[model samples]
Each structure stands twice: as structure tokens, then as C-alpha cells.
Target: MSRATATATGFIAVLLWALLALFTVGSSPTPPLLLNTLCFGIGGIVGLIWAWATGSVPQMRTVPLRVYAFGALGLFAYHLLYFSALRLAPAAEAGLIAYLWPLLIVVFSGLLPSETLKAGHVIGAILGFSGAALIISGGGAGLSTEYLPGYLLALLAAFTWAGYSVLSRLVGSAPTASVAVFCIATSLLSFPLHLMFEETVFPTTALGWASIAGLGLGPVGFAFYVWDIGCKHGDIQLLGTSSYAAPLLSTLVLILAGIAAPSMTLLWATLLITGGAGVAARASFSSN
Candidate 1:
């Protein structure tokens, strides 16, 4: 696919992730590991089915074992650190730290071969991060010293994801079908972890179940597949900068659903994120 098209495809994952907070809230009371197992299980099954139908399963055989291992570990490790961080620290602080991934992606993408990191990209990333920080922290940036471990884990989670995204480009030849294996492998890994550490509680209500299904079908499922394509072929810098929209859009989703109220914070976040994306787009256009 064209770079622009692939980048657009990758952005779809960001859009789908906008619903992540809502679905996660709806799927609550279920432990993170169990939720991870269930969501990835559903994602894996659906991905396998789609791959089979589209005759993409054969393509996965040609992908190296290390590629499979890397993809699986990358997905599993990020969630593991994120969940662990939240367990140890306040959600808002931990989430804000974890949300550093996008900014890291923009920075790290600069190191990639043939990719130039322009001043606009850096400025845009900072602007986007400021917007995300406002939303996640509610305009405060205080982090408790007692939660040092969690903060560290959250930082690692950010690096893990950004590294996973940037490194996916190194293994750019891997087929998107291989993400099915990654999801299944992640599910398999999560199952043992859940059994070891978490109680096996299923969702209590229809809405809870629907939420999990929605997460699997969109954010946790197709998002990864398209993201692989984008990271490998699209403008990774632009994708990174645009990802700040996920949190902004997520909050808007919550507001629209009546789960949250509109605020000045949201309004300012909207402008910062929009302007940041616009600046990054201008930079990308100039480069092309």
C-alpha cells in the first residue's frame, strides 16, 4: 500500500483505541490478566478465521520464528507492565506515564534508516504530549515518591511499546497475518499468568461481555494488524504524532456516553492535539 494509505490505516487503530477507556470501564471488575486473556483470545480466534478465509495463513509460515516471538513478547510485555504499574500506582499517574509511548515513538522513529526527524515533528510531539498530559493528569503533574516502582514500570511500558512499534519496521517484511499468531501467543501467555496471579471472574452483565467483544474486535484485534502495516510502510513519525488523539477522542467518547462531563481541560486538549497533528502533517507534506 502507499505510505499515506498505510499511515491512514494505522491511524484507524488510534481511532479504535479511542473507545478503549469506555470498553475497559464497562468490562471492569474482571482482573486485567483475565481481561487480557479473554480479549486476546477473541482477537486471536477472529484473526485466525480471517486469515484462513483470506488464504493468509500460508504467509505466516514463511515468517521467522524470532519475528513471532518478538511480536508476541512485545504485546504481552507492554500489557504486563501497564497492568502491574496500575496495580501499584494511581491509575491517572500510571496512565499518564504509560501514555509517553507516542512521544517516544516520534522520537525513536527519527533513528530509523532514511527517516529524518524535523523540528516540526519534535515540536508537534511535545504539543501532543502536553494535550495528553492535561487529559490524563487533569492539569496536574504530581507523582508520588511512594509509587516509584509503579512509575518506573510505567516508564518501561512506554519504552516497550515505542520499541515494539519502531522495531516492527526492522522486521517490516513480516506479514500482517503473523499478528494473529502474536495475539494467540499473547493469550496463551496471559492464561498462565492469570491462573497464577488472578481470580477467574467473568463479566457479570451483557454490557460487560459486549464491551470485551468490542475490544477484541476493534482495539485489541484489527488495531495491531493495521499498526504493523503502518509502522513498516507508513510515515511512522506522523502516526506517532497523531496518536495523541486517542486519549482526547477517548475522553470525548466518555463525555458523549454520559460517563464524563465536558471541561475546560478537554477543550484545551482538543486544540493542542489538533494543532500538533496539523503541524506534523505540514512537516510530513513538506518532506514528501
Candidate 2:
């Protein structure tokens, strides 16, 4: 794909991801483990079918086991921590904290053999982190010792995803097939987790089922494939910086869904995060 097409695909994938927070908003009758199992199982099947139809099925067996393992573990850990954190803390705060992955990506990208660390990247990361902090505080949930575990889990989720993205860059494989492997691995792994720790509670409402379907078909499934393509073929620095917009877009999704209200604090958060990302992107280009 051309750079422009890859970039557009990346943005579209990010937009799909923005809907994730909304889809996972309310407490569900379904347990997190079971929900993950079902959602990703469906996604895996879909991806497998797509791979088959596109003549990519043969490539699935070609992916390195290490790549499969890392992709699966990373996604599973992220969602596990994220879902648990949502239950333990307020969604807004948890979401903002988890969204720190983008900044972490910029920071960690410097460790790559082909990438260089830069002062502007560090400064931008600081600004972005500050903005995320502001959003968390703006939620008006004062420092309660009660939610400390949740906070830590969300931070870990951010770290885990950042590591996953960085590591994925090193994998030379068919992107769609890799995503299929990821989904299938996550689905299989979640089964034992659900049986061990959770009681299965299937969705009983239309909205609940819809959320599951949306998640399976969009964010959890195709988005991963698109993201892989973008990471491999697109403008890495620009995509890294633009990803800061995901949380802001997620917040807007929540507001539109009536799960959250508009606040001036969010406006300020947007400005800071966007400015920081822009600064980082400029620095990356100059360094290159």
C-alpha cells in the first residue's frame, strides 16, 4: 500500500479503537473473561475466514511461534488488566490511564535499532503524560487508596500494549495472519482463565450482544490487522503521535453515548495531548 493509504488505514483503525471504551462501558451480565473469550473467538473465526478467502491462510503457518506468543500474551494481558481495572475504578480515570500506551510507544520506539531517542520526544511524552494526568484528575475522583490497584493495573496495561506494539514491529509475517494467530491465541487462553476464575454469563440484552458484535468485528479483529499494516508500512512517527488522539476520540464517543458529559477539562486535555504529539512528530521528522 502507498504511504497515504497506509496512514488513512491507520487512522481508521484508531477510530475503531476509540469505540472500544464505549463498547466496554457498563458493567455486563457477562464476566470479563467469558466476554473476552466469546468476542475474540468470533473475531478469530472471522479473521481466519478472511485469510482463507484472500489466499492468506497458507501464510498463517509461516508466522514464527515467538511472534504468535508475544502478540497473544500482550493482547490478553492488556484486556485482562483493563477489564479488571474498569471494574475496580471509575471508567473515565481507568480509560485515561490505560490510554498512556501511545506516549509509551513513542518513548519505547527510541529503543528500536533504527530509531533514535530525541529530546523533543521526551518532552512531548512528558506533556502527553501531564495531559493524561489532568484528565484523570478532572474525573473528580480524588486519590482514594481503594482504587490504587486499579490504577496500577491500568498503568501496566499501558506498558504491556506499548511493549506489544514495539515487539510487533520486529515480526516479519503476514499481518492478517498474525492477527488471526493473536485472536485465536487470546481466545484459547481466555477459555482456561474463564473456567478457572469466572462464571459464564452470556449477554441477555440486545445492546449487550451488539457491543460484543461490534467489538469482535471491529476493534478486536480487523483493527489489529490494519494496525499491523500501518506499523510496517506507514509513517511510524506520524502514526505514533496521531495515536494520542485515540483517547480523546474515545472520550468524545463516551460523551456522545451519554456515558459522560462534556467538560472544559477535556478540552484542555485535548490541546495538551495534540500539541505534545505534534511536537514529537516534528522532532522525529527532523531527526530522520
Candidate 3:
């Protein structure tokens, strides 16, 4: 890709993911019971559109019980934690805090024989955690004791996501596009979970549906599509740095729209979290 094209695509990535997060903030409290499921429900439809746009899409297998099971499990837990966090805390809080998963994965990576932490990785992890602490504190004791549970829940989101990211690597040999199949499988699974857990399966409005579609398509659907392309064609360094830009963008959009009030404090946290992720990615990149 030309420099111009890469730059343009990068902008799209920044905008799409950030915008999706803002939507999550705005739509969560008012939305359908299974907010996350609704998002992915919309996402599955968008995934198909993207597939058709590219060319003929691959048909997913119905016999792969293991793949479907894993898919379902990942989506189910991620949504549960994600929506719960949104309800429990501010949108900016939940979004920025969730980025901590990069550091969590790095710390855990040291346990695996395949990954070894370097001096820089350790330093980055510490800095990242400290940065998050600062943001939570925010100038003069912005940390409400009430906010603790939401923070912990966001951390759980990070942990669940980190585990999923690592588990995903084990299956990296599969076709990149096949992840879409996994997502559809996730949707199939999510409906049942929503049925059991939510006690209802309904959204409030077209806007809520739109929000769900945005998540389904962008974060879960189109985001993956772009990511598959990125892995094939993007610079690892660019991907590392740019991945962190999402939360900042999301927070900014929310604040501007009067849905969330954020600060440059988010920038500090973004640095630590994204920096840690970059370190981990580089560490993994070097081992290969």
C-alpha cells in the first residue's frame, strides 16, 4: 500500500474503533438487555457485507463443535464483563481502563516458555500501571471509593481479553477470515446466553440497534476485517502504536457529544497501556 493509502486506512481504524466505543457509552444504559450480544448480532450482518464486498465469502462449517464452543465462550464472557463495566462506571473510565490487558498479557507471558520479558518490557509494564493509577487519581483525589468495583471489572475485561488474545494465537494458522465464522458462531451462542442471563432479548430503539450494529460491524466485524488486512500488509510498529489510539478517540467523541466527560488524563493512561502492548508485541515479534 502507498503511504497515502496506509495513512488513510489508519485514520479509518482510529475513527471506527473510537466511534464504536463512544456508541457503547451512549447506548449501553438504554439499550437492549443483551447489549453485547446485540452489538455482535449487528456485527455478523456487517461481516457478511464485508465478505461480499471482497469477493465470494467462505462458508463456515457446522460440524466444528470445538471452534464454535470457544467462539461462544469468548464472546459470552467478554460481553458480560463489558456491559457490566459500562453500567458500573463512566464510559471513559471503562474504555480507558480496559486497555490494561496489554500489560496483563505481558506479565503472564513471562510464565510461558515461548515468551521472555526484557528489562524494557518490565519497565513499560510498571510505567503503564503507574500511569493508570495516576489517571484514576486524576489531579486531586478523583478516585471515588465507589469507582473501585468498575475498575476491577474493567481489569477483568482486560484479563478475559488477554486470555482470548493468547488463545487466539494458538489458532493463528487458520485462515484469517475464518474468524468471521467464529463470530457467527459467537452470535449463535450469544443468543442462548442472552436468553438465559438477560431474561429478555429486546433493544429500545433504532438508535440502539444502530449502536449495536456499529459495534457488531466495527469492533467485532469490520475491525477484524481491517485487522486481517493489517496483519498481512501493515508495519508491526505502526500497528502497535495505532492500536492505542482507539480509546483516546472514543473518549474524545463521547466527551464532545455530551455523553462522557474525559480529560487529558486519558492520554496518560493510553501511553502506559499502549506502550505495554507495543512492548509485548515486539517481544513476541522478536521471538519469532
Q: Give the candidate number with the greatest lDDT.
A: 2
Model 3 Cα shift for residue 248 (angstroms): 2.5
Relative to the true structure, candidate 2 reaches a TM of 0.89
What are the runs in model 1 whose C-alpha is more than 4 Å off? 1-12, 81-100, 132-156, 226-244, 273-285
The 0-to-1 C-alpha lDDT of every candidate, in the order given, reads 0.76, 0.77, 0.65
Superposed model 2: Cα runs more than 4 Å off: 1-3, 135-141, 171-174, 233-238
How close is every model to the real structure, measured as TM-score?
0.78, 0.89, 0.80
lDDT of 3 by residue, 97-155 (tens): 77676566666666666567677567667776776676567634687567777777777
> Which stretches in model 3 have alpha-carbon errors above 4 Å?
1-11, 30-33, 52-65, 105-111, 135-143, 199-206, 263-267, 275-288
What's model 1's TM-score? 0.78
Instruction: Return the candidate ranking by TM-score, descending.
Output: 2, 3, 1
**Number of backbone collisions per candidate:** 0, 0, 1
Better of 1 and 2 by lDDT: 2
**How big is the positional error of residue 67 in model 2, measured in Å on the Cα after superposition?**
1.3
Query: Which has the higher lDDT value, candidate number 1 or candidate number 3?
Result: 1
